[model samples]
Target: MSTLTFRSVSLRYPPRAARAGVGEKLVLDGIDLQVASHELVAIIGRSGSGKTSLLNLAAGFLEPTAGTITVDGVPIEGPSADRAVVFQDDALYPWLDARDNIALPFKLKGVPLAERRARAEQLLARVGLADAGDRRIWELSGGMRQRVGIARALAAEPRFLLLDEPLGALDALTRTRMQEFLLRIKAESGAGALLITHSIEEALLLGTRIVVLSPNPGRLTAEIEAGFNAEVLNGASVAAVKASPIFKRMHAGLTGLIHASAEEEIAA
Candidate 1:
């Protein structure tokens, strides 16, 4: 069962300003979300909307102030091998080459060098970096580094993949290619993916469901069903599908929701 559930989860940060004389700063409130096997849930919002916070909570990097998150009914106490995270910075070891970086997790697990190398090679090919495996971290481009990061995450063989703006740092063309790569990887891995992104188009294209959050103590503002991800997985032309009427409709509606939420924040 590829199930991840967050029930009424909330996060609050202690007041940092001296003499501010305020209560805790709430970042997330009453969040209820679920991701199932073969599902991609995209989280989108403006800056400071706690998009990354939700991902961090899921990764066990931070504990919520209240509520619970479970994986297949088991409470999440800390990071586990069954869950892997890909950050926006492509957090690879600077000293390691691409192949070694991808295999690092395996090596830590006591996997023989040969077996880890073989698996890393396969993952490299999967991410379109077949020939770049020998390149050191510094030798690759930003997009290439992120590709290696993805390969490394897959090395862990995680059942759930948590991504925080995984493609946000790439150039437009590279980002587009990586989106396709992401879709293919998700299909092949059959893992539940929760991606936090700023680009609404990216969210709509990559997610079977899109969850929008409001600013300042982020809360779920809207939940949209976007099946274009399924279409892309089924070999449908992504560009053509994006241009379809339903896509346009949902995009317009979501944009409106985001704007309304922003306006609400301003008015408050």
Candidate 2:
């Protein structure tokens, strides 16, 4: 059971002398968050809310100015296989085919070709790309490439999955289907996920817990126990859960919460 925890973590860009005369920039402050293997936490807030900053910190791309971040009780000093990130931009190698991209991490660890191929094939199928394993990255569509990116992340078998608006580029219908796909993946892998998204409905649909952050120097403004997928876990259809009254209520409430946060930001 892997867990990621942040204890009063704060991140800031040290005072810069008059680039725009803005001076110091505090991106995030006093963030305390935890994600267990059994839970997926979704963070939503307005643009410039430092949502991506929080994910970058967790991914070990940046160090916190204060407090600490730990994965499975150990300090995260740099990027490790324990945390896998999927950015909005698909970062697949253009020279490689889908299967090769997914198997890259295993290859880095010196796994034999036969084993890596089998593992990559399994992950491709898990991401709904079973037949597209050999297709070159250039041959895939934007959404398909994104799926391969996710498949690559899955192949790492990371304890924590960090997603930054991974589906923000998809059409509405495709986004919905991908949401279902993500839920299935989470069910199967039980890996803790931290998804930073701009969509309230998306967060409500997939997150076990939804967190809202305030703007500028982001801070946790609200946390909601979504549990919207609870019924889905009991064999209820995704469509049924999406159309349920509870989902509608929570959707409206979250929409309001976002608006309230935006107003607060403007007023501050």
lDDT of 1: 0.90
Report the C-alpha displacement of residue 93, candidate 1, in angstroms: 0.9
TM-scores for all candidates: the values are 0.95, 0.94
What digit string (tens of lDDT, one per residue) describes model 1 on residues 1-268? 5799999999887525354536668899999999997789999999989999899999998888889999999999888877899989998998889999999989989999999999999999998899998998999998899889988998999989999999999999889878888999988898899999999989999998999999898999999888898888788877788799988888888889999999999999
| Candidate 1 structure, TM-score to reference | 0.95
Q: Please give, for residues 1-268, the per-residue lDDT of candidate 2 as tens digits.
A: 9899999999877534466436678899999999999888999998888999999999999899888999878899898878999889888998999999999999988999999999999999888889998899999987888889988988888998898899998888888878877777877877899999999888998899999998778999999998876666677777788889989999999889889988887788
User: What lDDT does candidate 1 reach at residue 234?
Assistant: 88
In every candidate, how many clashes are there? 0, 0
RMSD of 1: 1.9
Model 1: runs farther than 4 Å from truth?
A: 15-23
Clashing pairs in 2: none
Q: Pairs clashing in candidate 1?
A: none
